[model samples]
Every structure is written in C-alpha cells, then in structure tokens.
Target: MLRIADKTFNSRLLLGSGKFASPQLMQQAVAASNCQLVTLALKRLELDKPQDDLLSPLKAMNVQLLPNTSGAKTAKEAVFAAELAREALQTHWLKLEIHPDARYLMPDPIETLLAAEQLVKRGFVVLPYCSADPVLCKRLEQVGCAAVMPLGAAIGSNQGLQTRAMLEIIIEQATVPVIIDAGLGAPSHAAAAMELGAAAVLVNTAIASSDNPVAMAHAFALAVEAGHSAFTAGLAHHNNQAIASSPFTDFLAAL
Candidate 1:
C-alpha cells in the first residue's frame, strides 16, 4: 500500500495506454493489469474537440490518469501541455518529459529538471522521465517530484533494462519512489526489475504491442506481484561456498 500524493496503490506496477490496437482492447488490458495508474501521451490527444475519443475510453477504465508531455521539446512547452492535460482530464498528475533532440528520443536533463520544478510548484504531481544519470535524478528529487522515472532503454526499442546498473543506483539512492520507465519488452524484465527493488515500472510498448494484450496484461500483473514479493521477502544472496544440503555439523559428528 504505497501512497503517492493522495492516491493509494496496492500494485506498484504502472501501465501506459499506448500502441494498443483498439480502445476496447486497451480497456480489457487495463482491467487485467490491475494497475491503478496509467500514462497517456499528451501528443496523441486532440483536446480541441468538445468530446475526446481517447480520453473518454480511458476515463471509463477508472484508473488514475497520468498525462505525459511526450512531444514537448522545451520546459515552457511541457508546462503548457501539462496544464492542458489537467484541464481536459481534470487531474494534476503529470509525467514530465522534454526532449529537444528527437533522434534518440532521449530526455533533456536540464529541461526535465526545470520543468519538474515548475510543475511541482504548480500543484501537479510531477514524475519526470530522465536518463539513467544518478545526479540528474537527485536534482529532480530536490525539486520535490513525486517520483523519478528513468528509462531502461530507448523508448519503444524493446531492448529492455539497458540501464540496469544505473537503475540500481537510482533505486538505492532515491528518497521518493524510483519507477523504471521504457524499453521493457516482457513480463520477465518487469519481474527482474521488481526483484532489484525498484518501487515500480512504467510499461507501455511491451504490453500494448503484445499479440494477446489481455493475457499479456495478466502476465505482467502476476510477474510484478512475484517480483515485489521476492523483494519484500529479501532474496538470499549467492555464496561462493558449495555447502551441502545435509546438516554439516551433524554429519561431521556422525563421521
């Protein structure tokens, strides 16, 4: 039962609503995932319409909406986008992402930190996605972000946890929740991350792009549970010694 802002979440895993073949599939997947929080890219929305098709379906899911500034290239632009999302969605929760260079779709650390600070001050729950840079994560934390979202790999690449080592650092050092975002392609990858003690993982492409989204969502739900349980139970550390399963001291006495 982790509480972020005012919301209580039983499952730490967060699902993103993108790339699903249809809105009906998306709704079913969201239900199967049992993920209370879902991210939506602001760029995909046509807010000018009186009634938003995407937002309408997503609202029906009843999950907490986390609007993301995916296409914003500057801090100012990201701020504006977040504001609009709030107006449309009627929620202040936002995923702050600003990448000037769209080639790799990497987050601009400077712009991210700047936008996060501003967003935090504006009564928005800012969760800024960033590189696996530990220092930048700390900087974002200082601005009082709700959580730190660091990419596992390039967005939509399906490479999966490329920043494993860096993520470990971020998880270990972060005061707020550390959510691994992007490039997770399977349930096992999500499970491995939870086993590594990440507070949560934000998955979009992997689940949405799956052949059977409903099954995939259920698979991820189970995997996240398994990983979180392992983390809480404290998995045994590997040892160099090859100890016998039988009682060594009793065997020695018998010998």
Candidate 2:
C-alpha cells in the first residue's frame, strides 16, 4: 500500500479526469484501471452547479478525489483554487500545480513550493506537482507535502520520462511518495516508471485519448502491477561482462 497524508491506497496508478471523450467513458476507464485516486482540476469543475454533470458521475465512482490547482499562476491564486475545490468537492486533498507558462506548461517551483507550504499549514493534504529536481522535491517534502509529483515530461505531451535520471534521484532521496505525473504515452511508460521505483503515477491523456479507453486502462493497470512485481522481485543489475550459465569444463565433465 502507498501511504500519503493519513490515507492508504492499494493502487499505485492514479487517474486524471481530463481529455476523455465522455464522462461515462472516463468512469469506465477509472473502473478498469482500478485507480484509487483520481485527479480533477478545479478550474474544470463547475462549482456553482449543485449537480455538475461531470462531477456527479465521478462522485458515484467512490474513488478518492484529487482536486488540482491547474490554472493558478501564483501561490495566492493556487491557495484560493484549493479552498474552492475543498468546499465544492468536499475534500481537503489537493494536487498543487502552478504553471504560469502556457507553452511548455512547466510547473513553477517557487509558486508550487509556496502554495504547498500554505496549503499544508491550512490542514490540506497537499500533493505538489513539480519539476524532476532532487533539491526541489526535498524542499516540498520539508514543507509537509504528502507526495512530490515530478513530471516525466511536459504535461499532455506524451513524451514519456524525458527526465529519467533526475526522477531516479528524487525517488532515492524522497521520504514521502514520489508520483510520476505527465507525459506518459502508454502502459509501457507507466510500467517503466514503476520499474524505476516510483511509488505511484498520475496518468491522463494516454488512456483517456485512446480509441478504447476501458481496454487501455486495463492494460495500464496490468503494466503497473507487472512493473511493481518486477521491482519487488529485484531485477538484475546491468554489467558489461557476461557469465555463461554452464562452464565449458562443467559441460565436458557431464559428458
């Protein structure tokens, strides 16, 4: 189980409720993926509506809600968005993401850290989305973030772990969970992340955008399990020299 801020989740695969063809399909995908945590951007939710069409179905799914501050460019704005999500969604858990740049959709380390600090102070279970910087991850963990979400690549780009080296460092040093978020194009990518010892991953565009969302979600779930199993089984390390399974002398003796 992955523990984060008083919650224990059995599934390491977290799903994002965005870019899906329909809310029903998203629900089906979530069901198929068997993800315990699902991310929904606060900016996308209709807070004013009592029964938001998109949110109602998600609520029925009974999975843990992870409301994100996606559009907030500053710490203050992010905090406000988090509060609104808490009130509307009835959950204090938040995925803190502050990206001022529209082109790359790169998370602002300064703003993210600041927002995480504030949210933690306010009794919110904060999971901050940040760059794959070892030092920055430590800083967020120090500020009481439940988990550090480092991008595999640019958000929604489906690039797949461009910052693999940095992610390894973050996972090695992080006291809290390290969740690989963004830029995972396929189940293989998610599996690769798990194989690298990531505690969890948040996937959105890949499964949602696939032609068969439910089937794709199942593939991702299986991949995550397989990767975790491989990690736990202790994969062999790389080496330049290869040793023969049976020595020549041993074979001759058998003969």
Candidate 1 ranges beyond 4 A from true positions? 44-52, 246-255
Tens digits of per-residue lDDT, candidate 2, 186-225, equal: 9999999999999999999999989998999999999999
In order, candidate lDDTs are: 0.88, 0.92
Per-model TM against the reference: 0.91, 0.93
| Candidate 1 lDDT (Cα, 0 to 1) | 0.88
Who wins the lDDT comparison?
A: 2
lDDT of 1 by residue, 1-255 (tens): 757767789988798888899878888898899888988876553668664376666667677888899889999999999999899688899999998887789999988998999999999999998999999999999999998999999888888889999998988898988888988889999898899888888888888999998899999989988998999999998989996887666656766
